[model samples]
Target chain A: MSDYSSEDSETEFVLYRNNPEWKDVTPVKQDDGEEPVVAIDYTEAFWQYRREILKGLNKDLNIELDFIHKVILRQSKNYQVWHHRRVLVEWLKDPSKEKYLTELVLAKDAKNYHAWQHRQWVIKTFNLFEGELEYIDSLLLDDVRNNSAWNQRYFVINNTTGFTEEVLNREIDYTLFNTKDVTENESAWNYLRGLLLHDKGGLSKNKKVTEFCENLYKSGNHSPFLLAVLVDMCCEQINEGGGDSVYNLDRARTLCNELITKYDTIRAKYWQYMLDGIEKRPKRARVKRLLRAQIKHMDS
Target chain B: MFTSETMPSLKFVPELHKKYLLFILNGKLPNLESMETNRTVLMYFALAGLDILDEIENIPPERKESIIKWIYSLQVVNEEENISGFLGSTNLITKENRGKNSPYKWAHIANTYSCLLSLLILGDDLSRVNRKAIITSLKTLQLPIGSFKGAKEGVEDDMRFVFCAACICYILDDWSGMDVELMVQFIMKCISYDGGVGQGPELESHSGSTFCAMASLALSDNLHRLTKAQFTGLRRWLLCRFDAGFSGRPNKPIDTCYSFWTGGALKILNAYQFIEDPNNDQFVLMTQDKYGGFSKWVNTVPDPMHTYFGLAGLSLMNISGLNKMFCELNTTRRVHDCLKKIQEKWK
Candidate 1:
């Protein structure tokens, strides 16, 4: 992607993420006892391989070609990765056979999550599988938090095949989310009944989404985009009411409790979304904390 | 921690800063100190520079709220004559008796585009904008030659009007506003002997005109009429303009705004990738000033148009750590997002 030499330290960081010594610099790490990231060698090979692929000499660089044999695939946790692998299948020499084989091999290993989602994407993209619903009970055990797969489950149930109301209800509870519109409280109330019916579902569905948003705050996704997304879902759970708006506001207050401890300008956009999610009427103390946090953030 | 060095390539930050500030503070272009009421090609660079700097805070809150009021004043919808939108550049001869900010006549295509952009940049939701007035105004601009004249009177009818119309039509999110087939046909006729698009048929192919033509087409989303062969030729003509920066025509000295003009054309054509050269950073940097503003070239005085585009050129190269600024102006995503939101809300 650039002209910098393989030895250039700046260029080295692109591939040096997983190396033990460079751990502080990169968020990437390897599984224990694996080869420490060999950046210079990898970058050299990548450049040479890219040169061959770019100038009409060769097309396939085969970064992941014929490499993984582990049915237990955990390459990336994101749904985007699952989507890309499906796209990558088309660029392969024999797409249908090759991707199908890859899918089967992956699923056979420890019931892979994204690989399962890839199978769903392939099934959905090409319209191949007709009887996929027969296996939803078994597949839901792979990862309960695989919201994408569960999201797809609703799509499959609604679009692909008819599921009994009982099954849909069971699946929603077990899947950690129920497809109730947070926009209207009635939908949230119904969903609460459904979520309580399955697993250790102690809280109502509204409480669960709120708790889920709080748990996400435990991570560093306090950016405005994240809070905006969270509040939107909460608002959607109870559409356009001052009450739901107030409820979301309370949740936002809980989310930003650590403002004096940590918060800055770069993170201010996310804070704005958090405030907006409360329908722009935040707690006075929280407002004070936010102002102090923003001032300190901008000052530094 | 985040600095200009973290961008795709370094241009003159000082030059860029100076040019951008000039763009904001009413640039000193020879005798032209500032535009009073009407918007021009200059405002695109000016507003775009503000976007690049992430400094919407500099814009007064009421600028858009009032500008909307001002644009409304220029609209002559369903009048005695089919007088479309006209730009009121002079405050001297108008109905309103103000020495300041009165778009005192019918609106023009370019002003319509500028006013809308100014609104968007000011972060105003465009709910109050009169799309119909602008669209109805656009309908009256078409001449017999299939090209558009700027206004009903003696204004020049050429590629600039076409670009402005395209931008206006685009900003309104309505292609029904313009005669798309005729516009495409007219643009097709403007293809010069060199396969480059021009202002009108037989005019010399220029970077500014080429951008106007290409952007109009891209905005219209009538790109299928523009064949791949033409795109390839355009791609070639555009890439050849580069000597650190791009020129408007072949063998012409590259100017600063062509970074946007030619670069913007290349961007619309999806051919920006072929021109990304890491070695050319120094050439781009030459346009930069250590204090502020970018010049057209290395040794010139800095201004806003170049400043806006120099940053845009670097953005096309996907410089790391500049993602926030880059994503905001992401042409495809921004348009597509707007379109999707409208569809969902209206659906």
Candidate 2:
């Protein structure tokens, strides 16, 4: 029997330095004294030898997982550590505990990209899509601005039920309700736009969504995201070339003007670019025309 | 001590920033242990940061030669495993197992990209690079899904590696290393509903991944693969990211690095001119450390990565006293031109 102790818990974990089996191994310290810029101490051989020893001893999978968990606690963003964890989970063939591990890491740092990626992989590979929506909802409830949660919600919906007509309606309603609470919440607005994209006729075809935006606009909500979506719907309407093409074009132009002059002034140049495109004028001509109009308006 | 009121001035301070990079290049800071795995990337940032500051000549020629040699020593050309690229550090290869075929010693795509650019920045000719071996090995890293793994043993394959692969092939003046059509398809699939690209399919649309995808497409001459609507959508998505500096995702805090990632993507899309430059410049400058370098956010300790990208973000705005950067390759114009000449010779 290898000297590896199976009784070790997470807190009482033994490192290579304390382990009697690894005492003979002369661990290479990083040559930071010589090379200041690129002194990487651990080599592939070091890790390979450790893995070989673990495999040779027929060590419990929990020990390896605990060791990785300890390392991840310190270096949550390390790609290699997360990759090793994934490999071990696959070997263990039970992903039941993986989500909990990722959750613990994420609870510490919500935007830790590696943790999120690993969670997504475990959830997808093991078909553990159940309750993922509730998990996402809890994350968003904690912080509605967590874009990662919003993205995971999209991922779960797409992979499981998909964006069926019924699913789309439900998502639209959910996203609309959230948008009403925080009209400036870009994530919720982006989510709504994502749902509308799944519709056959694009943003303009979603009468329900258009009505939502119109109601919000009429109610004195001038959030840049809200106006941006309305402008997109109007442009779609103009492109589809129905009886309301003229009205839609006029509304789109007015919204673009408002976006530039009043709301969304930070992105004024983009709004101007949109206006130029709507008028189908050359860029230089559009710029010159805008300059002339601004001068005329200022003089008047 | 470095509040806005006490901020020195709204100046680029190339000298102070260059001093910080030199400290990174010549001096050993104890805090760099966390960056041991990414030593090559750290070196690239220092060297490239100096080049951007127009102070590459500060490094004596002998030191430059030694650095060049060090970079070349990390190259692995194993024909059996079809692995040809640069490792991040020599710590992975001990004397006993040196030159042996081990999965752990596989060359990494990101390391290779950084090493190649570092070589050109140091004025090394392309004679030492094993073009054939590297390109041959690069072909094996591509997956059927058109994305690329970082190495032969790498489990994580994403847009970052795809970008690195594109940079490697483009720098070597070869396209046989990857399947451009499939790669383009993969990038297209990564376009999230928000119109920004992500690390992979169904992932969150992030500024860094969007930059990687768009820059890869541009480098591979596959920009035309995007439909007109997709192009417009991408432009809108990029333009919408600007709030003070920029954010990787919606509702995220404005970070200094996104100034380059999102700004670099906009530069490629011809939409960078639309950004409110003064606000971005002020935001980046506010994050400048009083000692030297820029941090990810104001009041944070500055690191080499954020410092290099802060300079890069300014370089995109054509900041005074800074060298013009070729945003696609993330190197200076002079080095890019040198690379172009090397490619011309290859043809």
Candidate 3:
């Protein structure tokens, strides 16, 4: 951010002053040029570089061996850098090779959204299949609350190809025991619920999530943000395609009341009305009407 | 890869305006606690970006009308008061005490350029903007040596404002903001041994300021306006920027915003057509969160300003599912439509 202000100090040599002068870049390393070469024009060298870039990107191999990383690092904002990288990645489509490369990329920038996105791209496009709970466990060991890792965990268990009830059950056990705080517990709940929603292998899993949520409600720091997530998740279960009308409704209404008494925020209030809106009960209807009136005359 | 379906939430919003204005109400105009202090300034893009996307919902229509009306009120009407239609950076009208909080009572070329762009983006009729005042302001800002100052006041003159003045005059169908001959000479001077133009002649070429210099010429109806050597050099400099997102200069990390800043420059140079499309979309869209909003660099916080530019970069490719927003002006393709309208109405 401070670099934005560094504009004033460098008054001399204008733009890119004191930066490295570009050399006459050849398309290749010149496989056998042993003799001393003459100085070449930068513009011509630039053309050669672009020609090479296009060539590298246009390779027919299933997986390109082009060094797109080196190219993207040069001019960071151009469309060509992104275009070339994608082309090169598409060129490198061997599933076994791509899976190995994904691990290398994750190691290089553990939080690189682009690299991670590219790995997902490789998997989705190439049909690479693997179990990830063991890998996810290692990430949690480093930082249980790592948001991207949590997101990746969710992506894998829910979106990926290989998963079983046993593996996911293993996940619930690890997440329940290893997580240090309540946020992690809530996060684990969210991830596990995603699996249950997808029904990977159709083993009843939300029972584990249901048990965890029950425990968390009894004793855990409930931030409104998290509480909001809790209400939504509950609403999902209640609103399931063919849920138990009696059980889910009673639980939703009772929990909504519990949430309203515990959290006095607007979102909580709205969710309370929504849960109550499940049925046109006299008290709930009256409150909903009053809230709407207040909202209508909001400024007042 | 291009669809908005991957997003956890997909909804059109013109919500940031109220949030930003409320910050001013709270005496947090800079809103250091919030990331987008530049909103009041960049609303030109935000409002316009939304307009281009055709997603100006969440803002009540009547209130949106009033905000556009107020933004129009800030335009420098003419040269009589030594004012112009170039928009002032932040015009805070608090508690009936109007103009008390305006940082400086002058038109900033950059803000003015952006303000008109926002107006155009929000589908404002351009009749309210007084072209002469903005042109006068531009004329007043340009120094004798070919550089332009930010405002009419004794201010630091540089290439950024030169771009702003050029944009205002271009949109307004006027060129009073610049002495084109001297402007060209200054740009020529800024050209280093490499083709890229810097803040000034003898300055190093930077992707950011270089956009200003190049786009200034392009909008001025002077794409072939530079010396032959300068033109070729500009081409060379732009070609060097084929990195992941387009860095401002060498050894800088690629960020999403530059995709438009430099990508637009190449488009203006007629060089953008040379680059392929899918890579650009995948790159810029990578900045977008699966949940919401776009970030600057990868794995960074998402905010309004970069979101605007990130979308603009995609729009440059005419990517589906987004309004086509010009990277520099940040208005819809309707600016060219407006230009055609002006030509039709006047011709």
Worst 10 residues of 3 chain A by lDDT: A36-45
What are the runs in model 2 whose C-alpha is more than 4 Å off? A1-23, A26-53, A242-247, A281-300, B1-9, B95-103
Docking class for model 1 is incorrect
TM-score of each: 0.46, 0.90, 0.47
Q: Which numbered prediction scores highest in lDDT against the true structure?
A: 2
Let me know the TM-score candidate 2 reaches against the reference structure. Answer: 0.90
Which one wins on TM-score?
2
lDDT of 2 by residue, A218-298 (tens): 998899998898887766665555216433767888889999999987788988888777666334455777899999999
For model 2, the DockQ equals 0.30
TM-score of 1: 0.46
**Candidate 1 residue-wise lDDT, B234-327, digit = tens:** 7656665665557676534566667667777877776665554454455556677776767787688776567766766655555432212222
Candidate 3 backbone clash number: 33
**Per-model DockQ against the true two-chain complex:** 0.01, 0.30, 0.01
Q: Which stretches of candidate 1 lie over 4 Å from their true place?
A: A1-300, B1-44, B57-78, B84-104, B320-347
- Runs of candidate 3 with Cα error greater than 4 angstroms are A1-300, B1-39, B56-60, B76-81, B86-103, B325-330, B342-347
